[model samples]
Target: MSRERVSFTELTDVSQKYWPEASVGVSLIAPAIYRLHEYLNRLARELFKQYNLQSAEFETLCALRNSPEPYRITPTELYRKLLVSSGGMTKILLRLEDKELIERPANLADARSRLVALTPKGKSLIEKVTAQLIEQEAELVARIDQPGQLEQHLLRWLAQIESHQDDKGPHL
Candidate 1:
């Protein structure tokens, strides 16, 4: 089977015909951003599926594994860090617990909250998966002629966008 490949030129041509008033900047950058987002998402899903993990499950495990000693943290903290709702986090935690990948132990310091820690199995899984993910990411960008320069440019661009977000003005 074969797939048709759409070029950036075609995209710009279509945009130019459909929306003549739009700036060239938007026509180029917007589609590129969307395509990059889609490609990254698909890659992430494939990587997670290889380990039989959903994105949320992998993120939750990563949160616990990246925490301090014993790699434990509160559910509240996890949800906050992940920008997930309390109810949504609870469901993710429940699934992890059911899989024996995490445990909800009594928080000796605070009776109100429970500590979520990775099981040895979970720790091992995260370590292995994380390494694989990093390797895959590196491979994806390896073809770039100047990755460091690209990274610096992206960082500056993203920072500029973030800094201006609160200005309540038009953005490019």
Candidate 2:
């Protein structure tokens, strides 16, 4: 799983030599974006490993961390927000509770399900991890000049794509 990927240069070279009729720059756009996405995922996995956490576990913590004050949400809410199955969310919640990173308190609104909230330790740890993640991401982008402009371009591109998805109807 530690194999290196083919470079963008190689991809461009193939497009130019084998498919001369196509616009090489335009043709390579999606592949380039996909490669970057893969690299970012790998980077996040490595960072999470350093904290002895699985990516899903970190995501669960983050969902709670980013929630409204009191930092609590029902298991159903967590599963929906994290786009995980209810069973998967249950496993993640159990692991986090075992780690003492979160606590489940009785939900006054409903007796059937408990509210998941960050413990004092969980809150502090998440804040520290979030800061580190920001620092690491900033360092990755610092190599490029005009990073802010690049961000704006990406934001616009994302918005356009999302709008097209809207036209296609609801996501599954």
lDDT of 2 at 114: 96
User: What local distance difference test score does each model get?
Assistant: 0.87, 0.87
Per residue, candidate 2 scores C-alpha lDDT tens digits across 45-155 of 888888878989888989999999899999998999998999999899999999899999999999987999999888988888778888888888999999999899989
Predicted structure 2: clash tally: 0
Off by over 4 Å in 1: 1-9, 23-27, 163-172
Candidate 1, position 35, lDDT: 80
Write one digit per residue (lDDT tens) for candidate 1, span 1-172: 8676687688678778998677555536667878877777778899888888899999999999889969998888999989899999999999899889999999999999899999999999989988988888888899879999989998999999878977856664
* TM-score against native, each model: 0.84, 0.86
Q: Give the distance in Å from residue 131's predicted Cα in candidate 2 to where it truly belongs.
A: 1.3
Question: How much lDDT does candidate 2 score?
Answer: 0.87
